[model samples]
Target: MKRAVIYYSLTGNTMKTAELVAERCGADLIRIDMVKPMPEGFKKQIMYGGMLATFGKKPEITGIPDNITAYDDIILGTPVWASTFAPALRTLFTKKDIGDKVSAVFTLSGSGDNTKCLKKLSKFCPNIKNSVSLSDENNGKPQDNKGLLEDFIKKISY
Candidate 1:
């Protein structure tokens, strides 16, 4: 399958995980960048960005491929915010018809709580084949959860 990994990262963890997924799956890497940056600082970020995601607010994003049909399967990744996905991803999904094309979903959660996040994403991406989440300590570092990532990829890609 022609797979693509589309993701957004604020602190590099999601980006690192996305890179690994792309490399291992031999998928295209499409990074989502916001036209305007979010607020800095943890509290500010959680309050501002998190609320935006919670409220289903789509931020202005750049770098979303104009043609999303180039890939047969797509894997989405983002850092968890307010028990949900990033606003940038919300923008992409809202603007694009990515429901049936999504093959899998992955997330980087600092608090290790992503059940609701996964459910919310699954709502928009109904055809997902698999899903996984890595905690703060394990999200970026391959050594921490390589086995888990491999298992996730195997279930979907292989």
Candidate 2:
């Protein structure tokens, strides 16, 4: 079956995870990019990006596929922010109808606590078949979650 790893990343952690998943699953990579990119640095990102995520702001996104039928399995990927998903996902949901898709999911959280964000994420992509939460380690490097990543890939592997 064909697969697609659709994701949004701010600090590149989620992107890194997406890459690994795509490579392992042999899936296509579709990025969620904001029309006006978020600012760099923690303070600015927290103040501006956090606020948008907190408020569930659906900003304009680019580079995502409008249709979801190309892939039989989809892996949803994102970075946890303010106990919720980044605003780009909100925009992605608006642009693509994925409510009926039973997706495999993953999240990259700084504190390694993504329960809140995953709870909120289910509202967009409700039919999750499997999920993995990875904590920030090695300076937001995904390599630290090697074991968990391998397990997740196994469950979602076809």
Candidate 3:
């Protein structure tokens, strides 16, 4: 099956996981880049200024692939922000009609509740067949947990 792993990463953690997932599944990888990088102190702002933006929904992605329909499977990866999927992903979810495609979501965070994030993503993509989460300990770096990720890819790719 033709599959693709698309993700947005702020601290490189999610990108690392995306690469591994793509390699394991033999899927193409796409990186969602913000036109302007968030300010260096944006994390502080997200905390004090109310994480409303982050937790509310996904933000708009500037350069989404025009031919997303070509892929049979999509694996979305993101970092946990304010206990939810990053704002950028919420934006991507705005585009509907993905019902026939297979989908999965994965998250990487230093510390946060991944269950809530996955649940929220499920709402956006109701057809998601499987989902997974990886903490800082298992993210990016090589480890014995590769088997876990490979299993997830196999589960969703078909």
Across 104-129, the per-residue lDDT of candidate 2 in tens digits comes to 88998878778898889888778887
- Candidate 2, superposed: residue stretches over 4 Å from native: 139-144
Give the C-alpha lDDT of model 3: 0.71
- Which 10 residues in a row give candidate 2 its minimum summed lDDT? 135-144
Tell me the number of clashing residue pairs for each predicted model. Answer: 0, 0, 4
Q: What lDDT score is found at residue 83 in candidate 2? A: 94
* Cα lDDT tens digits for candidate 1, 5-41: 9999998989999998999889999999889897889
For candidate 3, lDDT tens digit of each residue in 1-158? 77889888887888998998888778889787555556678666467323545547444567678877678778888888767777776666666455346378888865524887777677777777787767777445554345666777778654
* Top-scoring candidate (TM-score): 2
Error of 3 at 60 (Å): 3.8
How high is each candidate's TM-score? 0.90, 0.91, 0.78
Pairs in clash, predicted candidate 2 = none
| Residue 112, model 1, lDDT | 63
RMSD of each: 2.6, 2.3, 3.6
